[model samples]
Target: MAIETTSFESRGERCAATWYLPDAVGERWPCVVLANGFSGTRDWILPDFCRRFAAAGIAALAFDYRHLGESGGAPRQIVDVGEQRADLLAALAHARRDPRIDPRRVALWGTSLGGSHALTVAADDPDLAALILNMPAIDALSGANVEEKRKRAGVSRARTVAITLRLVGAALRDLSRAARRADPLYLGVYGEPGEAFFTDPELAPRFRRVAEGSPTWQNRVAARFLLGAPRYRSGTFERVKAPILICLAEHDLEVSADFIRAKAKGAARVDIRTYPVGHFDLYHGDAFEQVAADQVAFLRAHLGPR
Candidate 1:
């Protein structure tokens, strides 16, 4: 199998992507359109799953949302949930147009926030053959107390202060732009304790590892996303008519299984699997293998032969 670097347009901006193709030749393959979590890039651990999908005789297209990673968008490092969904739709169109892909069997797979987008897209796109979601952050407005735990995560005071000041500056800059209906402020995608983009200690090491030395990975996002997240709901899981596989982390501190189930109750066909691992753990090691196997089986069952 060979991985090809690629790009496609979304709302006139280029969205960078990678295409993983299986060895099967002359046959149009069933493809999976993969989108990454919250401010995540295609290169950040997603290649592992995409490789597995290719190994299972499927093609996988993992893409970065506009304004993030290698995508072409101004006022970078922001996560507008709506824009990300639109980017996925654009990627779907790109996949459909590819001669190597079987548009009728194209599937959608996403993780974390990207999972939310996958469900949202599947809700409206009846042509999709299957859907796979991992630890989906279904409700952007999930007013959880996890922030307190993130605040308590240990980080050097000097670094924290520096990041905090930078966030404040970015916020001010964004405010000025917004007054004229210009671009919003940019903030770090993740930071240590007492800083904006903060994640808990349990998740920080993994995030930092995924971010290290990645050419397309940026440590920033639009600060105004904070204001819109609470109102951004991806509860369309119920509206999805495709066969859906939802993987939940048993010890997930971010998204609750109960909440996910509540939203998915109305789905015509849903299979919920619980992994005895944390949210970030499924991106690697044994947990990833388990989930990837299940996903391949599900996709093969739903999408059929390559």
Candidate 2:
């Protein structure tokens, strides 16, 4: 399979992506629309999965959100969940328009925070063929307890003050930009554990490992995103009419399986699989192979020819 560079406009900004197609052309094949996790670009780990999907005779469209990776936007490294959702929709629209893709059999594959976007999109677009979530970052604020955070990585008073001031400034800047409909304010996407930010330092090393290899990956996001992150919720699980496949990591402390299981209780059809590994482990080694095989099987069962 030869992966081709692709681009699309989302909210007036260009979002970059890659399209992987099987050698067997002419026949319109089912496609998977894949996006990465929090503060992540499509260059991380996504290519591995996209290649596997293409090998399975499925077309894969992996994309980077605007302002990250090869995508286009100002104030680089800002993580806006709503804007990401828009990017996913734009990718979906692009996939549907492609001549080699089967528009009616399009499926969504989202990892970590991207999973939240996948569920939210699937809920509203009932025509989607399937949904796959891998250790999604849902309800991020509710995960860490105050006491546990303190134990994980204690913070100095000076660092605390600095973080507070930075966040306050970011929030104000974000508000001002919104008023004028301008680009977002930027900030480091990761912080040490116990610090008030997106991912803990304990879990932040994964970003370093991924970045060591990917030139497109960066550790930044819009600081104003913190203000709206907690309040944003994907309450569309019940409305997601497509078949759902959730691959959960047993040791993942960020996203709780219990929470997802509870919210998706009303879903029409859901298949939940548990892997005995940490969150990032699922991206490589035996765990990655297992997850890929299972996902291929699931998509084959649901999105394959009728």
Candidate 3:
């Protein structure tokens, strides 16, 4: 596959993007956008997913949300939902204008955090042909609470909640300051640095190696993300007009499965699949291939001829 790297502006925010095309494939093929997870970059993970899409003659573009990787933006490491959505919109516009893609047949493939973005984005854009949610997180209300984790770490609920809230507020304030170009930053995005939560997983030793390999592994997330992201709930699924395929990992420790179950009911045109494995397993194991095959099959069936 011949991959091209580039950038685009969304609401004047510059974002990095990449287009993957198969050799000899014409511009008549449908385009797909691959949205990354909470701690992810455009090519942060493996481009194996893009290769699969390319082999099927589907043009795929995967890019970083601004400030995380190559994308340009202030407040590095912040995972604000609104900003990521703007990036997704920019990516869609760039894909549509590309000479090798069929703009009318464009689709979205989201993983983890991107899954929620995909759902929200698809609901607002009616032109999408298909939507794929691999371990989608439409309900932030469903995940493990920061307070609970702190409690388990020997911190009191009141203290933990208060601490987290303060951090979130500080990060937001930092962003506000940056927007105004007030001065060089003193506090970091994590808002008073401490050990990150990704390292606190229950099965740390077992999955640590692969988890550490994630492009965002060493990167500490900004506290502003928790505060900046609109608290997303699955109730909006009713507005999603595109066909959706929801893939869930049965043993996911990051987000609650029940939240996904509740939201999957919103979309009248929805298909759900469950895997016996955990969250990271879907990214690089037999389950990954199995789920990819299912996703490609679903996309092909929906986007291809009868």
Candidate 4:
């Protein structure tokens, strides 16, 4: 296997990427473009998956979204949904343009929020060979009801209300800063309930454990992004024509499995797999091994030599 450092332009910004290529003799090998989750860098937990794909005779391209990691963007750590989708598309284009990659056999692999971006991008580009989504944050695609979210998260109505108010305040502050051309307010990516954007108590430790060796991963994001999150819904699943593999974490506190199932019901070529673990579990330990193996098998079956 060989690894190459690369960069791609997205909306005038340079997005950093790494290509993991297999050592096989194929003139043009199948490729998989990978995007990281919210606040996740290209170096975080993604290298493991990329290595596995390369070992299976598939090429993997992992990139950092603009405004995060090594990518070029002003007012760093902001998570703009539209910008992220565009970045993924840019990565896809980069992979397709590479001489060593088979454009017709290029696929997309994403986890968490990245998965949702991949889904939306694949919906527009039907010619993609396949797609792999692991514990995708599809709830963002539909603007999941606040009450239902509170109930599922086991948080009281009052606590949920407080959290919303806090988010609004932070968003307003950041917007005001943007208007004044000042620094933006930041919010932690993981924290205890009602403390941060991702209010899962266990996420902090799990994220730390998974991102231990990664120096580029940041724990904060611009607060204003939360203001537009509710309106960030996408209705492109039904339009995606490529074969898709959806891996769900049954006990995920961030995104409910039922929400993903209901949204994916209309997609024609989807294979769903549910694992008895939390959202972060799939990034480490035995769960990671099992899920990664399943994904490799899926990729081989769909993107194998043709």
Per-residue CA lDDT of model 3 for 1-306, tens digit only, reads 788887888666678778888665434788789888875876555377888887887788988888777777765766778878878888888888977677778889988889888888998988888999888766665554444445545767676667666656666675676578664233332222242434344545534553455444334565446555545654677888889989988877666666777867878699999999877678876987998888888888777742
Off by over 4 Å in 4: 141-155, 192-194, 230-235
lDDT of 4 by residue, 1-306 (tens): 999999999999999999999989847899999988888898898999999999999999999999999999998998988899899999999999999998989999989888878888888897999999998875553534455547767888888778888888988999999999899899888775544677655465776774577888887888888776623244667888999999998877677788888778888899999999977889888999999899999999989777
Top-lDDT candidate index: 4
lDDT of each: 0.81, 0.81, 0.73, 0.85
Give the distance in Å from residue 132's predicted Cα in candidate 2 to where it truly belongs.
Answer: 0.3
Task: For residues 103-217, write the lDDT of model 1, one tens digit per residue.
Answer: 9999999898898788788889989999998888767545232533434554466665675566566666776787787866666566643245655656677766766746678
* Model 3 TM: 0.83
Q: How do all models score by TM-score?
A: 0.87, 0.87, 0.83, 0.93
Candidate 1, residue 218: Cα displacement in angstroms equals 1.8
Candidate 2 per-residue lDDT, tens place, 191-246, comes to 64223354466666676787688888876566677676633254567788999999
Model 3 C-alpha lDDT versus the unseen true structure: 0.73
Count clashing residue pairs per candidate.
3, 6, 0, 0
Off by over 4 Å in 1: 143-176, 181-184, 230-235
**lDDT of candidate 4 vs native?**
0.85
What is residue 12's positional error in candidate 1, in angstroms?
1.2
